[model samples]
Target: MQASTLAALKELALQCARSAGELSLKRMKEPFTVEYKTSASDLVTAVDKEVEKHVISMILKRFPDHGILGEESTFAQDPAQFETLWVIDPIDGTTNYVHQQINFSVSIAVYHKGEGLVGVVYDPSRDELFYAVKGEGAYLNDRPLHLDRIVSLEEALLCTSVFWNKRAEQMGIDLIVKKLAGKVRGMRLLGSAALEMAYVAAGRLDGYVSLSLNAWDFGAGRILVEEAGGRVTTMTGTPLPYNEKSSVMACNPTFYEELQQYLHVAENTQTD
Candidate 1:
């Protein structure tokens, strides 16, 4: 695609993300209904659907031909084959939103032929927007974001999510967290993958990992973190696929290799 086209789409994404985020913020202060997706812990709120539909409508209004995939809608369908696509998570932390009334976000990323071109993640509560375009720098709000440090695992503050449904998967996740609890400065379950990655991009956290996450959960954050000079890959250190469920390890450059080693140790312990 032409540079101008990409820039236009990036601007559109930013607009949509901010609008959707504000909608979520308004809902945060009001009464909302909750519905369970797979289990009680895997949740959806009325606001999630409303914001997602609104974002999708705006994207299509501007670019009717572009495809859309959202967490609250179209998640089950395959989106990777579309030549041009918008992947969005209207509310990334529904549980947090329902309970803490904070820590949620709206994430949007535009892709051409399965490669991300524009990414925007907005935290309405903090009024922070983390964004990037391919080959351009990343930013948090108006400030340039730089994942400019390398810290050892002992000093890294890594964030992760735990599975609630699959016992096998949850067990593996527990083992990894158990192994890292003492070695890392701290581990946090922010309950929002997008926010966790935004924190990593801003250098507030050294790394973020998850046993498995959907594309909408991390697509925007991946671009922001990578453009900020960080690396993202699977726990075993492979490319993270954007179309399906997968594991992830996003880290500052100085800590990727060490984090990978620790992940390997955790897996070994889980198996043993």
Candidate 2:
């Protein structure tokens, strides 16, 4: 895509993210209805749907030809076949939003084929807006962001999550964490994939080990990490899959392969 077009899209994404985030944040301070999607721990709120609708309307109005692949609703645009496709997670950490009233975020990414063209992850709690466009550097609000220098597993601070709805998946991820916890500087479970990835991009975390995330969950943060000089890929070290749930290890290239080796083993051992 042309630089101008990409910039426009970035601006559009930023606006939509900020709008959605503001909507959620405003409603967050008030009482709202919650419902379970897969499990009691796996949740969604009325605000999640409301904010998604707002975001969808904004995108459709501005770029109707564009296709949408959102968490709350599915649209008919094939990203692989179209010039532009938006993958959105209006509430990337609904549990956090519902429980703590913080740590959640609004995430959006526009892609062509499988390549990210524009990405935005907004944390309304902190008023932090992280965004990047293809060929452009990553940003944390107004400042440029970059990952930390390479560190060994022992010195690295790694992040991971346990799936609330999938016990076997949690067992696998928990086992990996149990094995690695003593080796890393520390481990963190922030409850928000987008925030965790933003932390990786900003050098707050050395790496992230994710299992069973949908395209909407990590799409925006993937490009942000890459543009900040980190790498995001599947457990086997290939590029992220566009239209599926997959495991990911996102960090700088230095220890990616080594990290993936362990994740690959964990994936195999963790079964339903």
> For every model in order, what is the number of clashing pairs?
0, 0
Q: List, residue by residue over 97-126, the lDDT tens digit for candidate 1.
A: 899878988899987887878889999988
lDDT of 2 by residue, 1-272 (tens): 77777878998999999999989989987889999998788898899998988998999998888888888874545555556789999999999998888899999999986778888999999999999887787999969987658677778888887534365345566666567777778888899998899888888888997666888888888999999989898765667876667777788667776777766766555431
Question: TM-scores of all models?
Answer: 0.92, 0.92
Give the alpha-carbon lDDT of every model: 0.83, 0.82
The C-alpha RMSD of each candidate to the native structure, in angstroms, is 2.6, 2.4
Query: Which ranges of candidate 1 are over 4 A from the true structure?
Result: 74-81, 163-173, 265-272
Best by lDDT: 1
Candidate 1: RMSD over Cα atoms?
2.6
* Residue pairs in candidate 2 whose N, alpha carbon or C atoms collide under 3 angstroms: none
